[model samples]
Target: MFYFDATYVLLIPAILLSFWAQAKISSAFNNYSEVRSINGYTGADAARKLLDANGLYDVPIEVIPGKLTDHYDPANRVLRLSEEVYYGSSVASIGVAAHETGHAFQHKQHYVPLEIRNSIVPAVNLSSNASWILFFIGMIFSIPFLARIGVVLFAAVVVFHLITLPVEFNASSRALKLLESRGILYGDEVKGARKVLSAAALTYVAAALMAISQLIRLIIISRDRD
Candidate 1:
């Protein structure tokens, strides 16, 4: 009863907070994208400079299509960026490029968290899609036992997201330190980089919070049936 009451009471504020966080992060990203960099280097160029500086000269930086689709693939040893981020000569671009490169740097040095995340990839992929569907199906059938089992499976998705928070935060931290120590960006550029990374971090935080809420909601619904 206490759990249900707590979960129900918190749902409204949680949903509203999620919306607010998303909007804030999106706005910060947009603002950073509009601000120019000191070196006049494009996101792709900054990425190249960082990679080359670190002797990762062979890692290709490509401009892929879409928004915020940037990532580094250790399997192919490529850093992919969206058109806006890859070509734009803005603080946001540099921040994103540096962040993704941080991932590559991590992969190169065999970071344990990234390694753990990579290991869970296959299972996470399956569970991400299947868990919610199974949980909903069980609820529709009025089977609390089945729903509870579905929730157990769904918990893996939450765990993956929780683990991801640290990986992302660490990447951002590395990116900021690299930019600051190497003097890659000047003036308000460092602040802008911090803004971008901090905003991105919030998205991960929001996702984890959402997962927690979903998990709580499922538990409440199952208990009601008992």
Candidate 2:
């Protein structure tokens, strides 16, 4: 039977941090969503401007459904922004738009970390889904070999999460600098943009922590089965 003990105890901090990060991002996004940019540029406009500034005129921007679902698809060379971020002229919208643009910039410049992250996308996706299934199966059957395999697979997920940190941080950093340098946000408006980006960054940090903690628990459980 599965029981909670020291293995679970080690995960408490990461779990708490994940909750806090979620709350922080939600609050920051909501707050900044209401604060309009001084220049009255919609999120799409901001993204286009950034892309044009970077000489990526062919990169198309599309409006997609869902909240906070903005992303840059390097494969398709397109930027997909959610409704709020696609049409809204608020500081939060612009910040989110710019952050995705940063990814495009990274792709254009061949940012090593982003390249590495993208290269492992397939492996990460496969492992992330399979790891839990393998782990639970091993737990149910008390199979040490299966559990070890599960742990190894899950370790890839942890590595993906860790590598994701630099990619995300660099994107946010690029967004902030581009926003200020390009005169998209002025004075205190930059601070608002920074706050939004910073809060979003915390979510990535939380994810890394949670993944690491889970991996540790898995390692402990695998050892105990021996």
Candidate 3:
């Protein structure tokens, strides 16, 4: 019965694209992770140098355990890097660290898009968790109103994904520029960082596309039940 649903068919392209994006990022990261930067700067060193250069001395860097789990927490004014990123001196490590540092820069500059994304995080979290439950209950009980409500809630997630595109792109752009301007990466070294960042950017694009496709699929499914 589930396999016969037209909505599932509509989502196939998105599923494929998501898989491709994930593979691209993983490959790019793996390849660059083996190539060390000329300056021998670890991810933690790169983050600190970038932050200090930008006059953000107070923002501290912390090591966390995970692969590619690096992030900047605006609330705590801290940058958290994974084990490899925090200790390794590879191009991939510095690139990922710089990207997170870019987020800290955005927070310091009061970037409008980042602020907007942060503002809706709580609502987005709630809606994302509730959307599936509401949709399944509505479908099982044949309640169009509840199903519509679920669709509307899910729309918030799509909106969040859309807003996230600019935020992510700007961060990568900042990372590349700063890495070069600050003389952290030289000549052909920057190319490897660019590849890693570019691959990461594609993942965001794929995510946005996937969210839009799913939203459209839900709309189609709701209309058919009517």
Candidate 4:
């Protein structure tokens, strides 16, 4: 009953922002991906250099096929990059690669936010799914308490997204700095790299906003039932 209620309109802004974020990242990445770095280091090469410079020689970088699906696997301590990023020496590729490697830096240094984020990941995973189930069942049965519980659970998802902002931003900051310092990108090239990372960061911001919007909608619906 709550799913398609007037409350559904609350999501419009977030939905629009999410679309804008996706488009921003795509445009920025595609534009910069065409501009090769002066030093000519592919994403993988830049990542390896950064990792090795930080004494993270053991961490491995692997290429995976995809478009901007790159990520750092903290558990396995491996960095996986998309085909474009792993091989392309473009500004966007190097920027994305450096951002993933930045996560490695955080891991090696035991960055507090990163650790905290990792610790709650399991709960967030469960909550993300269970929150909807509980909310739907509660709304269908008019169990305000159950729906409220769902709201609480979803709050964790929101928290995860919030913490993710700083983590992602910090990693991007690190990547930009490292890229400049390492001479992988300089002057206008560094500016382009920053643009790529900044665009990517907005996607995280959009996710956090969407999560918060859902939580607020759930709270309103549950409170009405109460």
lDDT of 4 by residue, 29-140 (tens): 9999999899999999999999999999999899898799999999899999999999999999999999999999999999999999999999999999999999989989
Across 58-162, the per-residue lDDT of candidate 2 in tens digits comes to: 999999999999999999999999999999999999999999999999999999999999999999999988888888788889887777888999999999999
Compute the lDDT for candidate 3: 0.91
The lDDT for every candidate, in the order shown, is 0.84, 0.93, 0.91, 0.93
Stretches off by above 4 angstroms in model 4 are none
Q: Estimate each model's TM-score.
A: 0.89, 0.96, 0.97, 0.98
- The TM-score measured for candidate 3 stands at 0.97
Deviation from native of the Cα of residue 209 in model 1, angstroms:
0.1
- RMSD score of candidate 2 (Å): 1.2
Q: Using lDDT as the measure, name the better of candidate 1 and candidate 4.
A: 4
Preferred candidate (TM-score higher): 1 or 3: 3
lDDT per residue as tens, model 1, 17-87: 77877787789889988888877888888888888878898999988998889999988999999999899
The residue pairs found clashing in candidate 3 are: none
Which residue pairs clash within candidate 1? none
User: Could you tell which candidate, 2 or 3, scores higher by lDDT?
Assistant: 2
TM-score computed on alpha carbons, candidate 2: 0.96
Candidate 2's displacement at residue 41, Å, is 0.6
